[model samples]
Target: MWADPNVRAVLVLLAFAAAYVLYALIWPFTHCGACGGGKRTAPQSQGRYWRKCGRCGGTGKKIRLLARMFGRNP
Candidate 1:
């Protein structure tokens, strides 16, 4: 299976995307809480401000893009 052209292409893409997200998540300056520069008075951003919440990790953005790409939601 690994020798297949399609399989190799997909594995390469998945590996690259995973590496990017891992780098983004591990970087110290990536989280908002570490930088400390945003106002958390808004209702939507209340719990997500400054990397306070574990769900969004201060970015206030969902990681649903990959889920959608794979035709699944959770």
Candidate 2:
């Protein structure tokens, strides 16, 4: 029941676990560091425009922390 302390503790634990799992799964597709996630434009004064992201290789996806830690290439 809602009044049970054990139930409340379990619910909190479950919520934290779920959050962690979600973060791990979706952390890879965050954004491109070079392109600023495709939101900003490159400087025109430098005579360069629409260049591909160097870090993410223009795919706009980053390597997940969990994947790198597990020795898997992203």
Candidate 3:
């Protein structure tokens, strides 16, 4: 019974869902992976000015998708 491919797929999917839910509860916010949690962009060769991060809007934080579903807004 446990060897069934269809059953195994469903179980794997359920496990992933459960893990994501737990992750959402434990960590509703995550760092800006795009910017490595930095508020500004690296200095470019074209100029020597720093700009705000595009991914995190210079805040260095991002709300998780499930957290938004749970009513935790940015």
Candidate 4:
């Protein structure tokens, strides 16, 4: 089975798909609570910039969207 090129390709594809699905399930995309998902306007203080998001720490990912849809916290 492993010797077949098609089988190998399919296995690899499946592996990748599974990994992506797992990752998405665990960490679905979410808007950052801080900065209001980057929509908040920053105040210029002597050319100073805004700090990192306090909720997602500037990662822009707060809670998982999937979890929120399911009424669960991620």
Top lDDT prediction, candidate number:
3
Residue-by-residue lDDT tens digits, candidate 1, 5-67: 999999999999898666545442322343343434457765554334454454534434444
CA RMSD per model (angstroms):
10.2, 4.5, 3.9, 6.2
Misplaced by over 4 Å in model 1 are: 28-74
Task: Tally clashing residue pairs in candidate 1.
Answer: 2
The local lDDT score (0 to 100) that residue 61 gets in candidate 1 is 43
> What is candidate 4's CA lDDT for residue 65?
55
Pairs of colliding residues, candidate 3: none
TM-score of each: 0.37, 0.45, 0.66, 0.46
| Distance from true location, Cα of 58 in model 4, Å | 12
Better by lDDT, candidate 2 or 1 = 2
- Residue 64, candidate 1: alpha-carbon lDDT: 42
Top TM-score prediction, candidate number: 3
- Which of the two, 1 or 3, has more TM-score? 3
Q: What is the per-residue lDDT of model 3 for residues 1-74, given as tens digits with 9 covering 90 to 100?
A: 89999999999999999999889878889888877776344556353327677788777789999988988785
Q: Would you list the C-alpha lDDT of every candidate in the order shown?
A: 0.53, 0.68, 0.80, 0.68
The candidate 1 region of ten consecutive residues with least summed lDDT is: 28-37
How high a TM-score does candidate 3 get?
0.66
